[model samples]
Target: MRLIDSYRDKKTVDILLTQIGNINVKHKYRFMEVCGTHTMSISRFGLRTLLPENINLISGPGCPVCVTSQGEIDAIFDLVKNNDVIIATYGDLLKVPGSNGENLYMLRSIGFDVRVIYSPLDVISIAKNTGKEVVFLSIGFETTTPASAALVKQLVKENIKNVSLFVMNKTMPRVLDFIANQKEVMVDGFLCPGHVSAITGERLYEPLVKSGFACVISGFEPVDILMSVKLLMEQVNKGKFWVENNYGRVVKSNGNELAMKLMYEVFEDCDACWRGIGIIGKSGLKLRDNYKEYDAIERFNIFIDYDKSLPGCRCGDVLLGRINPTDCSFYGKRCTPDNPFGPCMVSNEGSCAAYYKFGG
Candidate 1:
């Protein structure tokens, strides 16, 4: 098969690797890729093995499903168990276990209604076709919030009374400052998410640069990743910190204004808990007061009274780049992907899953 994009070509990667190896002496650097897709791509392409000895790439709390707090999962479980509601959610979330070791998938196996959907608007079809009530499990970063917003707008247009949203969506830029100021560990730079940056813009991450952290918006392709790393290195070499976009083809200075407008139209910023990274202020998206009628949390009276990850799961340290997935005692023993004990093992974009697939 012919590979259309030569970014993955061995020759190109070798050249970039050589250029990286010849850079002048500097302090050891930790570049955190704050996108789960970047983590998966870096592992899949064996990019880590080819990196210069001085530059270490760390994973951040990027995977939406993995970072979803246990309490939220339990709350959704409660909604399904106690209320007459059917859940429409992405397939990845179906198997993510809550506090009781049950997930949307297991609940479905026992005859609870949890429908896997590729689009948030699919809930409208379920509501329109069946007389039953439906709730869409909305989850993701800025890239996905627009879709949920569109769904809610459609609900208002069609006057769909039975469908509502259980919003678990989050945003990225607000968390960067919180992470940058942490005393436990320090990141030398950031490889921002192209997917999110396309919606939020390169400017959204300017604050990190202002705080003296080198930031670069990067794409998922191998060439893209190398290009971003190269730019970050240049920033370090000159003792300069600024926001740059290596993936300018998709990202813009201001980002997609229409998407942002639509997103904020129905959702408002709120403090949210990241499974491993603790709660950060205004990092989560919840329905606006005007959109409360479309909110499943209010409609179902769901209470996430409990919120705690499984004991001994070192996902917190793993996310902050303080430890590797293997550092956890249960990583390979009790936390294999087939039967995961921690949230990180369940998502393909998760650090543990990446280590399991591509070696730590």
Candidate 2:
């Protein structure tokens, strides 16, 4: 409680805000938060409104659920139609809109079997009890990949044959490089992800900083975000590009070795597509050769329809920071959380969902 409260302390928040306000900066700054949790916290805490007008905070492809390509979503539904594998997924992926607004939950309501689970470990009971193959639709950044890796090793150790992971996990460093190098986008700095930094370490962002962007790994609290902003403003004022860790409590210089080792043991880097962004090579995770038996994609031989986004849905552009959620024609009217036309509105961590739900 003390640790949590200390980060959220009003006095600290005020001090950061005052320090940030004291900077006589005149230029417009765009800082993208590469974590969905950070986006949600900024929106939930109304930190964006409190920040200096010169500093603009935008959402990135940080929401792993939001960035999941349409092909993966369609393939999951296609798997359900085959009646061979039981789809076990985490929460957000279920309702995320796919090609033509089809989702697992929508199909489940019409009698398709889809189960929401909290962790990859839960699939053990699911596969054991059902005798059918369980395809866990694994998705997320480095933070969640270790759990999937651990599950694969556990399956191999226990000789559990009924479960496999349809791994759609992504890497952060390469994608950040992709985003920063885009000439069309103007990103002055990055509010890097805390959890990803905890796994990959602060050095993961050092290359991007070297490429000329002020980067800061931030905690989720209001004060933490504000402090990061102040730090970024300082970077901008000094015309310096660098990386800093405002979330020092959780993130270390080198990050967690065990989690990264677990991930490296089971998965290898692969070229993967982002939802709005095109294919980023070596930006995805795939099962290693030894773990091929536990790979759902290899086991099932999946195919996708390759659907395109519907009209007036700027979700793809939103993911790239090309525009804001409010800029979308379907934002508040045609598209919403209830009847989401895009994945951005479907997931709670999505930028569109954050804007709509919290009125930020």
Tell me the tens digit of each residue's lDDT in model 1 across 1-360: 555367677788788878887886466878999898999999888888888778899988888888888888888888888887788999888777776677777889899988988898888889998888898999999999999999999999999999889899999877777789887768889999989999988888888888889999998988889988988988988888888889878898999999999999999999998887778889999999989998888887787643577788888788777888888899889888887877778887888899898875
TM match of model 1 to true structure: 0.97
Model 2: clashing residue pairs? none
Q: Write the per-residue lDDT of candidate 2 for residues 209-255, one digit (tens) a residue.
A: 88889999999999889988888878877888877989889999889
TM, every model: 0.97, 0.96
RMSD, model 1, all Cα superposed? 1.5
Task: Return the top candidate by lDDT.
Answer: 2
Error of 1 at 4 (Å): 4.4
lDDT score for candidate 1 against the true structure: 0.86
Model 2 sits at a Cα RMSD from the real structure of 1.4
- Model 2, residue 83: C-alpha shift (Å): 2.4
Each model's lDDT: 0.86, 0.87
